[model samples]
Target: MDPILDDHLHLDPVKGRGVEAAEEFADHGGTHLLVLNKPSWHYDVAVEAGDDFRVAYDHTLDVVADSTEVLPGRAWPVLGVHPALVSQLVERGYDPEDARDLMCAGLDVAAEYVEEGRALALKSGRPHYDVSEAVWAASNEVMRHAFALGADLGCAVQLHAEGSEDFTEVADWAEEAGMARERVVKHYSTGGVVGPTPSVLADKDELERVVERDVPFMMETDFIDDPDRPGAVLGPKTVPRRTRWLREEGYDEALERAHVETPRLVYGIDTLGTLA
Candidate 1:
């Protein structure tokens, strides 16, 4: 089989981290790495690594535009308003009605602020979506308007869903927008407080559902490492642990086979280096 692609990673040496981790990854033959733009300080390490690097940008175009100028190739930023921050906007005493109007006003001001403040982090980065609430609140007309802007920008929208409702809602929204599944990359982690943990690594029945749907989603292991606290991710240590889960769940061999036999089997990883 070919070398494995680690989808997510970090590298920031100035802080006495990232550098060593990145070097270790290089030595370990990790080819492609997904580096988020959030920690702008880490851009150096990712840039120095060259074309093997890809940036996961947030929603703003200016942020991504600046980064693209700085680092020519390998930039993919997903576009969408952050669902998590929606509640925060309300908490800040911004009238809900007014805030909704501001958001609907073309994401111009928000995009500008995001670019100026955290350009490296937001551009070519992922903006998360709250699947359940988005569906529950948005009218079909509102949903179409939002998706039109996102799709026109040529960025994938990363989704976070808790239950079957979340999952189905997203799929329905994509259909409504007339966007291909390939344009939407769903982020599936372990079962949340309310939903069933996705069987990305186990449960053939669940995995089959993903395949059957022809969804344009990728498998990303969202793990955070803490020296003082181990097993924070609820799995074993090292990449091998993830690989083992994939194998045990009949994913590894199958994915490799698909890569060889079938045409396109899209996948991604979250956080590769900089565990500091």
Candidate 2:
């Protein structure tokens, strides 16, 4: 496969399970993987791997230090705050204003290159604004903050926004917020709400829109389909099918080609090991 560069790769852990899976992938011509540094499991793996892979911290500042010390010249620390965390704060009785500020600060601390808008258990069935209003608000604030920082932080916020309707609203709101149109990138599923099929995205012209606008769109292989091993939530059988479909829709091929051709394109794996 010509040493394909996977933008996202998630590792599963059972003692030495996850990192071993990553090592196997590396051995098999995988160029780099983006590891989401979240949960106790991932933290343990990142601290262990050092620079062997790229790390994206879910909600921590210490990763900045690790990236500085380990990866140095690269954008070592990548950050993403869990929307669920915001939900947690709300549940804990924190004032909305205080909670929003704290979430904004977390985004600032890690210089998060991406944002994951996945559902928190409590916020899942509730109204979008009520369930994740604080998250959405904080996300908007961080967008402004990133612009004010005057650094092209090269961060791409990944919203698990479900479908086209919410996506349009989010994109429209971000545009109104003056977020650089070129910088805004949508995460997985481009149509119908939540995990839309590739056919849905391409059939509706969403992919063309993203390409024409040059938004850094990416899809993740979130630990469900493990190539090295099976039994994941979504592994090779699932993720690669989507990747092939996206390629058919004219998405760039691999991270290396994308880096050279469409530098804005990014990839990640939402699992234990880092993507180099």
Candidate 3:
């Protein structure tokens, strides 16, 4: 069976279905997942400083551990500070510069986890929504911090930013920071990304187009596993189900390139191979 990897996913055992969600993914033919840490607020962690981000990051690793107990090395944690946090700190009386410092510290903590091999990638991006110029500038600096960390650790950095397809500024930041362009992934990508690798959202039309491209790319559901949203971005089984659908539509070669070749090139995971 071809390895159906969901490049981005989230699971919560307390407020949402956790390991059971991973089982649902496995049930639908999914093989691996990059389980991302939910934003700080999700875990109600107080972000006074960088180390405070560890509360949420630690929770994410715990969730990955629980999932891996069953999946057995099929799941890995991706840790980082969410960019929207800058605004939240501002609203709560934190100076914008302080907020940026705090966010950078958070990424520092995340890099420590990556160095410890507790995570496979680092996650960071500016707010996907709009903010003031100061906040925006600060957030951009925080993004550079992540790119710099990616360069140092030689790990992937998942970005959750606001953009259609062209991430020219992001690309420039990564290049200036010395991070490999391919290791910078844009989560929830639609298609036609120019610089960073688009972990294309698991949508049929999007995949149909992206899979044909010669560029290295990936697929992700970005499932937050929030019961309240009940499939806000996409359902948990979207990736594997989409894979099966694409296969039936005679996209075997495309599947090989996207599912096996690109993942191998980006993540260095060897379990996935050419489509048989």
Summarize candidate 1's per-residue lDDT along 205-236 as a digit string, tens digits: 44455545433323333322234333333221
- Candidate 3 positional error at 73, Å: 6.0
TM-score of 1: 0.50
Estimate every model's Cα lDDT from 0 to 1.
0.34, 0.37, 0.84
Of 1 and 2, the candidate ahead on TM-score is 2
Segments in model 3 whose C-alpha atoms lie over 4 Å from true places: 273-276
The per-prediction tally of clashing pairs is: 20, 26, 0
Error of 2 at 2 (Å): 3.2
Compared with the true structure, model 3 gives a TM-score of 0.95
RMSD of each: 10.0, 9.6, 2.1
Per-residue lDDT tens digits for candidate 2, residues 1-276, read: 422323333443333244454444444433333344343323343122223112334322332233223321211222444444445556667765665566555445444233322211000011134455655665455444433331234343434333344444554444455544333434344433322111122222444444454433433344422344464433422333444455676665432233233223222322213323
**Model 1 steric clash total:** 20
Tally clashes: model 2: 26
